[model samples]
Target: MRRSVPMQRLDGLVDPRQGLGAAEAQARSARYGLNVIIPGVRSGWRTTLADTLRDPMLWFLLATGALFMLIGSYTEALIMLLALVPLFGMDAYLHRRTQASVEGLSGRLATTARVLRDGSQRTVPAETLVPGDLVLVRSGEFFPADGLIVAGEELQVDESTLTGEAWPVRKQVVEQGLFSHIRETAVEDVYWGMAGTRQLTGHAWLRVTLTGAETLYGEVVRSAVAGPHAQTPLQRSVAHLVKVLIVAAIVFCLALAWLRYHQGHGLVDALLSALTLAIAALPEEFPVVLTFFLGVGVYRLARRRALVRRSLVVESIGRVSCVCSDKTGTLTEGRLRLTHLLPMSNISEQRLQTLAAAASQADSGDPLDEAVLSNCPPPVEQHILARFPFTEDRRKATMVSEQEDGLLVAVKGAPEVVLGLCELPEAERRDWLAAVEAYSNDGHKVIGCAYRTLTSEAWTGANQIGG
Candidate 1:
């Protein structure tokens, strides 16, 4: 979600809790068009053909092919025209990939939002939203529209999409209650939830004060991404070489024709002789050879799931040595993997992973839990008595499960939290803490794991383990 810029909140403008009625929403939707910036379809065959023909090499091929047909060399003409088939097909394939990416992006930009309509929460299309509507936004979801966060705590939003900031921004609750409103507050104090940005961690109720072009992100949407005429160095060099070859072909053809005419040859004979030499000297094969090589590069890249927007980029990729990234979803898959295991002397590597998975809820949709679950299945036939969700204050989660022998308690969280809760020798704790620091210095995200077995005498209930 984009960070919503704080705006003047007029008193009596919103109900905050009841939100707008269904009929009012329908009327507003009719007044304002759909919240779309550039609703474009896939590139058609004509567009693909046009883009392919833009290659200067292909233009030379077409001219050479026409000349061949004029000279009745049907075989050469056929070969030149046949070369165009792969160029067109390559472009069509890449454009299809590019269109799919664009559609995926558009899907993210517009999503369904749960909002209060006539005192009841209903899932509605984001584009149908209007100003004065109250909506709910949760973690890992984009804010449907631009609005002010009326009530929420510990709300963290990923404003990097809009602000270009690498860090997550925490939002505060609105200080004044409903109807105590008539103040122009600073942006930092008043929590604003804008469209096109995502909520990173918390849930919030926001009053939609702006929609479509009225929102901050809507301004970005109005300014569309432009595709300019660009060329790689290889392409520029090839084009330059082709220009020089054409000039030389023309100069030699004119000089030879003038000499033959002055030596008593007929104008038609001199012209045909010059034309024949020009056709051979033109070196039209230069472009065909270059196109074939680059087309193969584009094909290889496409097979690797790399979307080559332009064939010229294929050459540039071969020259790339280092790639600087911001570690965002666009840069990488952003999926967590259990790469290493640091077990205590008494614990086996398998036991460590089992305990970590035991503390995790498979259905939680948390990346850490999923990564652990991917490695090992949870303990079988174990009934969960109680489970504590991770919170910012606690910084850890605990779960109690009933097994055949007795009750088992498992915990996983930040290293510091786990070390503090576990009963360890002072020297052992310091050693493990030092290990954790080493992992941190190596740029690894470390999660500490611990488990405890409880006998019947000690297995009271959830309170005995956590409280």
Candidate 2:
């Protein structure tokens, strides 16, 4: 069962028929703040400069430079100090450029949504959305915040970004009124849409329940910010080496100072000699060499149209052996076509496509659904009786259609999930599983589909299919 917190909160605050007044919307916006996901801010140039100066090698160099001046070697001291200027300047430049690039990308991805304010539909920046605001969600838009669906038509959302399941969940009206009006709700009479999920199909009026940091996406963003960052093996190794070098530098400095003092040198002169000795022993050129190699790698990647932001990432990128990418938009073109259909049963390819099409939402704006509908013949004089939309837990959606002969229940989803719902012979199931795996290995997006016909006994009494 789903909690009706969204409905309860929005009940009196927002008017389902009209929406929030202009003055009230402004007040709530001020109270709730912006509905934006604050990204992890990287360290700035000043912080980077401080970190570089604090390095054991840099510390040794600075100490050595001071010793040269103390011993009256003014030229040597000046040269040593000048050597650090270029290194610090280059590092600071890189940090500032990366920061600016990230800011530009973030600005481009910022979205606006159609909202009802003062009973007029208008578009506003998503960050301005607050609780009690009415948002008009349509196909192919990301939900701005968590909200209750006041009104919708065959609404289906793909929450794979949040739940990691590649299926669309249906949202409808709830029977028991969560709000005094707008009764139809979600799965098990709980009507709610989450932030960051894409609306695959349908148009709906959503009354904002939770906004900004109070929403689920906001919670995730906060959790990530609070969590400790995972260190790579290279980073850990480098850190350990730094600690070892710092300890070694201290010991060497102490030993050299004692030896110089025993040889009849003054205390200040002995300390200066020890400092110079320690700095000479340090690998001063190691950082420069590493940065040079990383810069080269970045240039090579840029030639191939890849942007490398951080120099430290070059080593990590080299260690990557495999690259996994999303199929629909990332690797392949946005357009998809159903080229082949392999059915386990005696059903022909045409029949299988027809059944799958019947279950798919034609205008859902989902690529897979659109592909299925495009390949299969258009439905004629068909009456959709009932539908059980897909959920993350169930992983499959079912549709009951009234045909000329009788009622047919169509099911389609991810291969393993849809297979679990049907009863199949062991040998046949094994062969079917093998086929799916074979297709998957060939880089095909395989979808499993199955159907069952009722003889006025099963679906008639139930009048609904449990998803």
Candidate 3:
């Protein structure tokens, strides 16, 4: 016999409910805290100029230019100065463009959810969300705050934006680890940054465990900002080539200066000749050429709908030996649709309509259920029975009501569960199982719906029923 794991529960959590006074909402907002904006420091013109002058390559070029000017080599000095202008300008333009992009991103505001507080739900900006606030999350809604699962059944959330994991993670109120246990599961609310997750079926409430810059997604963005941008292969190779050229130029210049001096050339003439040689040996136009190549790459990548954060990163992409990608969004469309429906028995058209109507009414707005109910005819509202909410564990929803002939029961869930509950012919069962396996192998999700008739005396709660 197998032993069951006991469910864990904690305290100090509140359920989300509608109805809050204006004052209460304000108080909640105040208690949670406000969004803080940090400004970037501006660089002064003098500072920028000093930084440009401090570059080793720039210093070398300047020294060469000065030596040429001292020896009356005006043409070479002017050429070297002209080369410096474009390199400096390109560097300035790239820096300004990057700053503008970051600034624009900071200015855009993300939407916040209206969550229940002290009996009333109030809409607030996402930035205003604070830890310990109760939030309400629903199907087709984004999570505004990061919180612990307090009270929920079958809550599945898509964390691809933050975790980069394609599959939706199933969440429960109970803590699963140290990070999860930090918040009280009873009063956690889901926030908007995680809004891409859709409710498949079932209701849940979350308490705000983290907010603002402390949220998991916020941390991810922060880390990305701090992490070094990947360098492209071209950028790496170009950098290496530049270093080698500089070293070769210096060695060649020293050798020529010694040779010219020994050949009875005057100090001034020999120094000027060495400087001219250095300038010629160094590819002063390399920086300008590399900048143009990077610009072309950036334009091409942008046209393909790929944003290159750094120009150098483009070269890195060219050097990648292997690529890893998630199948859900990268390979296939993330949305799952109902492609086919199978009714268990050869029921009348009217009976089919009734079952569909009942399922629609208690669907909790899941996409799959909505699709099934879309073509359903008008249902007899009065004949509807108490709804049994769908849960991942049970994998089914059962509807039952007293009928004039007997008791009518309808069940819907994963095919395996429905098939096991229904007494179908062996051949038919094998065929249906085969169909389900085929769909699964083809990457199409499949579900089953079944209906049956029984005596009122046989009715029992879902816990007592084996199916």
For model 3, residues 91-114, the per-residue Cα lDDT tens digits are 565456555655653543246666
| Candidates' C-alpha lDDT | 0.76, 0.70, 0.59
Cα deviation at 286, candidate 2, in Å, is 7.1
Question: What is the total number of backbone clashes in candidate 2?
Answer: 5
lDDT of 2 at 445: 80
lDDT of 3 at 272: 79
Provide the lDDT at 47 for model 2. 86
Q: Write the per-residue lDDT of candidate 2 for residues 177-244, one digit (tens) a residue.
A: 54665433433423777787778867877878777777766676566444443454765676577567
Best-first order by lDDT: 1, 2, 3
**RMSD of candidates 1 onward, in order:** 5.1, 9.1, 8.5
> How many backbone clashes does every candidate have?
3, 5, 25
Worst 10 residues of 3 by lDDT: 1-10
Model 1 has an lDDT value of: 0.76
